[model samples]
Target: MMGERILPGSYFQYPPPGFPSVSPHRPSSIPTDLERVYIRGKGSVKDSVKEEKLKDKPGFEHLNEPLHVLVEAELPKDVINSRLDYVVAILENLLKPVDESLDNYKKQQLRELALLNGTLREESPRMSPTMSPSMSPFNGTGMKRANYFSQKPLI
Candidate 1:
């Protein structure tokens, strides 16, 4: 026969009265029905001292469900870390655009291209008799024909 020792209730689960530091030995000022009807009268009064005192009591409206508990139960460490990073990234994105730093670079590149295209179009009309098919910058430039036609002014 395996004689196993049984643990006390206090060993596993601590009740309100068990934890003296948390549970108050004294009674609360939230009056009983008779006390409210007779002693306190019709109108209710706020007892700040009692309210503050009650807040320190055990089971003083402490939520059973905490976010950390859920996170620990459902998600692994790596998954949690990844999700945390993703949330941080999303928050950063919402606060600022995704391509914020690249905006200036993109704008500068666009400006440079516009200048190059403008110069090319301007120089296209001034082609002399010496300018051959190979000499033409527009010919076989690999740029789309539509881009040249759209930007190129009719002579």
Candidate 2:
């Protein structure tokens, strides 16, 4: 009876204003948050009015873990020294004689320098190549004349 009341041609007319007859759903790959909302026949509407839409969403908190550089393989050892005991011994043998010779030469040179500079008395017992003739114990007055003892009278 109701179908007979409405004209058959009226059934094919467009849906009432602000209502869609059938709506097609979007695929899952599309994100819900977008700058524009699209309709099939009409291009799109600006989504600037969505500030309130996001007000109820949860806020994100920062995680506490430290950031680090990525590495592909294990690091190599960083040892700083060589381990041969003979190297130390060889160094000792090579170094000791030179150091000893240097010290001995320094002492001898300092002694000779002191004698040359006259800090040492000329009468001091040290004999040197540049010592004066009078300074030597082997010189004229330094040697005693052979003592002639009168044990018996000379003829």
Candidate 3:
């Protein structure tokens, strides 16, 4: 949770990394179908806005499995046992990533990375889909692209 800034459209594991390794949520117990998630937060389960958020619902969406994310400030033992799936861990990854400000250069770097990783939709294709993977854009020399981008700060 402390290494680098979580940029827009970047995928990260919840409870990012400074917390102790021995967490109650070890990523396996989470339910594949999140419809059974029970949230302890204020407000009804489905508000008008929630339905819209569900269209682009957050999760490993490429796999076609939508997850129901439950938010609870404090986990109640009785509530845990009542749900179809159990709460693996009690975590509160605050909205700090959304609030952080980034410079134009950093923003561009994130954009480029997103494009390379296919996270962000590309405005234009540099190469056609028909292009073979073996063929290099520059030449077929098998030269490795220099990557200077690192999420961790160099000390």
Candidate 4:
């Protein structure tokens, strides 16, 4: 029930580039996924997937798979992404000065998970000066460079 259509060929696709290929009607033509499936073939992603599984080895058939979008498609008016909801909780935990017994460690673990999952990234410490170079100066990082030969001041 999302307002926008997600994938191609659930309905007719309006690909301007592919129009040239499928324009002239043919008498003896078979629809291919690339050419016709994207143009005229109206098939649900779920049905296509179900057909694929039938060709799989016996006992390898998928049971009770969660198909996010397609065949037997009946979605409610509202959908909430639980992962995104959890992300809000993660941000709150990371931001607030939580001092409970395991709170700090829990936040640390959450931060690591967010970073590794590519859900979030560390913002640059020195935010771009709001005003200007002349009006306001940048808060340069204080991380001192370490080296065997010599040391360079970070800021």
Candidate 5:
């Protein structure tokens, strides 16, 4: 009895159903494609910086100056104004359709609301306090009652 093993009863029915097995070949380290690209880009940037440093040495000083000077050249005020006007026109053209559609949508919604209001009014006619005496507890009676807390004591 010392060596004998006690087996627990099976919880599932006989001929148990098989489940889909998980893949055994999982990667040891998850590789991120973006991280790899970023690292590669970082290395290229470092190399470019090193190249720029090499070009900045004593013999290559004159080569560092920009080939063209843009600050001295000035465009006419009319040309700048024309460009600004063109940009504004393009923006207006892009927004015109959207504005029209929004206006039309608002009009349609107002019409729908008006129709709904008309239907609701027709379904239940407006009733005055005089028309339904049973519904209103105070039917236009101006009589006032003394407040319980503010009542005067008998002398």
Candidate 6:
């Protein structure tokens, strides 16, 4: 089964370039506090040494200090409700122009539809008699009649 290998031995032995290799010195024991552990970015060994030196400096040392709690003052319910009402009034004022434009568009559409119906009604009487199959010249005739030519050919 090893002879018919789907992957080569070198694939398991070495990782691809730009990736970090597995550390040989990794401890078998697990740490109790995961939150205290700080993870470092994928950087060079020289960069890690430089960071350690910077941490030892007095100016950069304050970053290691514990964070302070921030206290916020509670807002009154009346002030919050007043702000919401002002926002709603502003939104309604903004939408008034849009509502007016939409109303004008709807009126224009109704006027156009009325004009179209008026034209159709005026043209209907002239179209109705011509459109019927029984009113056609060829309806009673057994032979097909050529309406365009004056005389029928001796075919």
Top lDDT model? 3
TM-score of each: 0.17, 0.16, 0.18, 0.18, 0.15, 0.15
**Model 4 lDDT per residue over 10-83, tens place:** 12334232121212232112222112211112232336676565535464332233221211222344532332
Report backbone clashes per prediction: 0, 0, 3, 0, 0, 0
Q: Is candidate 2 or candidate 4 better by TM-score?
A: 4
Model 4 residue runs over 4 Å out of place are 1-68, 71-114, 118-120, 129-155
Residue-wise C-alpha lDDT for candidate 1, range 65-136, written one tens digit per residue = 211101111245445455444443432332233353455433444455567567523345746768776766
1-155 in candidate 2: lDDT tens per residue?
Answer: 00001112121244243221111242221222211112211111124244334334453111111211111111223311121222233322322333433554435545666776778544456667587778677777675666678446577
Decide which is better by TM-score, 4 or 6. Answer: 4
Global CA lDDT computed for model 2: 0.32
lDDT of 1 at 112: 57
Candidate 3 steric clashes: 3
Cα lDDT tens digits for candidate 3, 26-89: 2222332432323212222246466445545564232232322342323344543433233323
Which pairs clash in the backbone of model 6? none
Model 5 alpha-carbon drift over 4 Å, by segment? 1-75, 98-155
- Shift in Å, residue 31, candidate 1: 48
Return the TM-score for candidate 3, rounded to 2 decimals: 0.18
For candidate 6, what is the TM-score? 0.15
Candidate 1 residue 116 Cα shift, in angstroms, is: 49
Q: What lDDT would each prediction earn against the true structure? A: 0.34, 0.32, 0.36, 0.35, 0.33, 0.35
Error of 6 at 25 (Å): 52
Q: What is the C-alpha RMSD of each candidate to the true structure, in Å?
A: 26.8, 45.0, 18.9, 19.3, 34.1, 30.0
Segments of candidate 3 deviating more than 4 angstroms: 1-35, 45-91, 94-96, 99-122, 127-155
